[model samples]
Structure formats: structure tokens, C-alpha cells
Target: MNSAVIRLTKCSSTKCLAMFQLSYHSQPKVALDEGISSHRVQVGPHRLHYLRAGHGPHTLLLIPGVLGFGWSNFKHQLLGFDRDLFTTIAFDPPGNGYSRPPEKTFPPLEVEAETVAQFMEALGVESASVLGYSSGGRTAMVLAALHQRLVKKLVLASTHAFILPDEYKYSRSLDCIEETWNEKEKNILYGVYGKENLPKLWRQFNDFNERILKEQRGNICLHLLKDIKCPTQLICGQKDPLTKVENSWLLHALIENSRIHVYPEGKHSNQIKYAEDFNMRVQDFLMADEELSGTNIREEDIKLAKANSF
Candidate 1:
């Protein structure tokens, strides 16, 4: 489907606003498989873009990190999951990726969560397992809290409930993305955001972090964390520079039915760096018959699993 165009009609709900049209361009090179299909739908005031894969009883909703879209951040899960048993849907939040025209202002996380809930409603997804990576986790926390019934299971990867002063400082230091990001990372971002907008967006995101630090005391979804009642899994990278491993522990402590898994040498983007292991682990957790135990898994267990694999 070259030059694939998705026509999104305005939602017919009472709360929905006026109708708007959107033209979506699906790149041929990035189209991974026939099972994955890209689409756009009008959700309230925003035209949301998303990718859907598989057709099964179970559903997985993937929320990407800051400046991330559905395909770029979640290609692995979209392709790796068993299509016969589980369906995966990944979306671009308002003002990001193909969902735009409103432009991202970095609204409060609760508002973002509402948008997500609305998006799911528009798509007819009643409930699903949710995986939110990095900043997306903030929105996911609020979603699980505000719309509890919409989330069956929750996964937070390299994310934190709130930002620390040091984190804000680190964010400020990354204002010049060209200097802070290595070539490979920069290339990936450039492919998603383009050369002209990538740097500006990064700077704007840094400014947003600063505003949250000052106005909201860096609390994105800390107040809502305890309200999330779903079986939660927190994936942390031990060597992560963005979100410290301690943040995962904090999240585990706050969410009663939560557990943590640490990747010894993994970094912030370990979901991509360790895609196979990460995918298998998430699949196991999401597919588990019963709720997994809480707190961190033992180091010896991790070693034992690795040894058994070998």
C-alpha cells in the first residue's frame, strides 16, 4: 500500500468535538510484516496514529517514551509476540509522531492519561496489558490510576514516578542533544523526528522537565502510583543513567502487587538493547497464570536462569 492514506472521521460521541481529516504516510522501508497495520483515528480533539498487530483474546497496549512513536519504540513487541494468542497495539500520543496538529505542550500527566483512555475508547479496546517506557510510564501510571478497569496488567520500563533535582540537572545538561547523544542514538531519533525538529523537540522536552520540577515539584504521577491496583512489572536497567534502579524499587514498594526485574549491565534503552530477553520476560509476566511475587528478583535466580539457558 504505497502512499497509504488513512481517513479518520470525527468521533460520534457526545464529548467529542468537531470532525477533522488526517493524511498518514506509511513508510515502506519500516513496514516490518504483513501482520502489522498502521492506522489513524479521531479521538476527541486529537488525531491519534497507531499500529496494530495480531488478533487474539489478549491485548497489549504499548506507550512510547518522550518524542517516541508506536513503531520506532515498539517494533520488537509488535513483531515478537505470538500473533495467534495476543494482540499488540502501539500508539503515538498527541502532538507526537503522526498524531499532531495540536502540538505537544507537555500537559499534566493526568490529562495525558485521560487522552490515552479516550484513545482506547475510540479504538474499542476495553482492557489490555499496558507497557509504558521512560516518560510514557508517567502517563501509564496515571492511566492505571484514573482508569483502573482499562488496564489488566502494567509494565514500566526505565521510568520514574517523579523527577529528582539531579535528574532535572541532567535534563538541562542535555539541552544540546547533538553533544549529549551519540551518533547511533541521534540517527534513530533523527529518523523518527527528522533533522530540523529533533533538536528543538529535545530542548522543549527539557524545558518541560524543568517546569514540572518547579511547578509540580517534579511529581508526574507519584500521587497516582499507590492507586494502581493491577499486577505491575517494573523493568529497570542497573547501569541506566536516565532513571536510577532505585526508582524501580520505590515503585515496587508503592504499588502493592508489583515486582521488579533488573538487567545487570543494561542501560535506559535496554528494551531495545536486550530485545530478545526483554520480550521473553515481558511475555512471561503478562502471560503468567497468577500474579508474580513482589519486590526484586534474586541475583542468584537471574544467574541460574542464564546458566540454564546456556
Candidate 2:
């Protein structure tokens, strides 16, 4: 990995473009029970793949992990959220799954969040509830802190608000996933990561972990937790190896209006593994916060969000 891939963005973009995906990924398949559609939108110079389902009153964004795509990660929710209650949207972040890279990599965490906000703006969504699982939760935090007005509510599951130095080595160890993967899992990996590019992908993961633990350690916006005004819920599986349950508790204690949901037998991908429970809890929260109270996101704030380009 080069230094460029690890550098953060510092430009702010106020523009929006509806784009399309030029690539595809092996994603978990699940049929939408009702009106659902796929869409592509431009964020800066990249095109993002996302899913749209239902016509509920509230807008909810389901953000996936590093390798998790919009549809595959939230397959269970494609038709789970009733059309009369919520409009659910999920997206493949840059450098992940179906959203291929013209940039060849992802932007900084800050830039990623702003790009997501711009994606919503491009789609004419003024504000939305955000749910980020694992890495996506970190993005949700940045969105809440900097682009405060765009998030109506928040749900973070197995998120990384802070990463310790040791965590880098632990993250690097994840490359062995390919070694133990079953045929089905291997197929998924082949579809999303490609078989020929395994070595390159592993190197990229190592490089990313090094940069995260060394260059960007403890910078997952924990300091900005106080700035996030939307009602937040932090969740974690008790047995999670990557991110501990205590981290969620710490996040709960920091965010003024935040709460916590701990899963006794949950792991890093608990939300997806326990999709039914997670979705149920998410719906319950969103329903209760129907009139979600938060600082109004203004045009100026959205501009400020763009200014965070690395």
C-alpha cells in the first residue's frame, strides 16, 4: 500500500450526481417482498451501489462493514421493514463489494461519511436514520458529529469507535479467513474479492490495518461523540473478538442521549448473523423516535461536511 491510500481528504463537495455501477459482486440473495429498486450515485469521482425499498415515512440508511455491500449485508431487511413504516436504503461503500473503484481505494473515514451524506442529497433525501455495522458504524459516527443535521437517528452495531495498537495485528490476522472458508463462503469471497486478487487484497488489508492502528489509532471520532446530538444506540456481541463489548458501553457513557444493546452470544458480524433480532430492535427504536429530535441539518452544515475532505 502507498502513502496516498492512507492519506485523508480535505475537500468539501456540494455537488451530486446519479451514477451507475460498472461492476458486480457475489452477494447474498434475498428477494424484496414489495417495491424495491437498485440505484447508483456519484460521490466525488466514484460511483456507489445502493438499494432502496418500501415507501415508509422515515428514511433509514443501512451501512455495511468493509466487505459488506448494501444488498448482501441487509438481505433480511430487503422486505422486512414495512412500506408503511419506513423506507430502507443500504449502500456499498467505496472499495467494497459491488461499488468498484475508479480511485482504486477508499477515501478517509471523514471523507467517506461526507460522501455518503452527499449521496443522500443527490437522491433528494434531506435527512435519514443511519445504522452502521462494524466499520459502517464508524462512518455513522462521523456523519452524526460533522454532518449532524443529516442524521435523524443512529444505531451502531459492533462499531469501532476506537482502535488500540494491538488491534492492528489482530486485524491483520483476519487474512486467514480464506484458509478456513467453506465452499459457500469461498464463493462469496470470490464473487466480492475475486480469486486472482487474493494476495493483493490481503496486502491491502495489512496496509490498511497498519495505517489505521499506527497513523489513525484512537481517531474513530470518539472525541466527537459529545458533538453527536441525535439519539444513538450502540450494540455489541459479548463474545466479539475484534471489538469488545465494553467499547459499546464506553460509547454509551459518552454520547449524551445514547443507549446500549449487548448480545450475549454476538460477534463482530452479529447484526447480520442475528438479523431478525437486530432488525426488530432497530425498528423498535426508529418507531419510538418517529419524531426523532435532533439539530436541524442546514445547507451550511452540509457544506461544512464537504470541507472535511482529507
Q: Provide C-alpha RMSD values for all models, in order.
A: 9.3, 11.1
Off by over 4 Å in 2: 1-34, 290-310
TM per candidate? 0.84, 0.79
TM-score of candidate 2 relative to the true fold:
0.79
Which runs of model 1 end up more than 4 angstroms from their true locations?
A: 1-29, 293-310
Evaluated with TM-score, which candidate comes out highest? 1
At residue 160, candidate 2 shows an lDDT of: 65
> Residue 63 lDDT in model 1?
96
Worst 10 residues of 2 by lDDT: 1-10
lDDT of 2 by residue, 1-310 (tens): 2111111122333332222323343333333333667767877776777788888889999898766677667777765777788998888887776566532354577888888888898889999999998878888999999999899899988986766555556666666666654576556656666776644665575676566666765556667877889888777899886777656656665666776778898877776688888878888888784443332333553343333212
Query: Which pairs, if any, clash in model 2?
Result: 8-310, 9-309, 9-310, 10-309, 10-310, 11-309, 12-306, 149-297
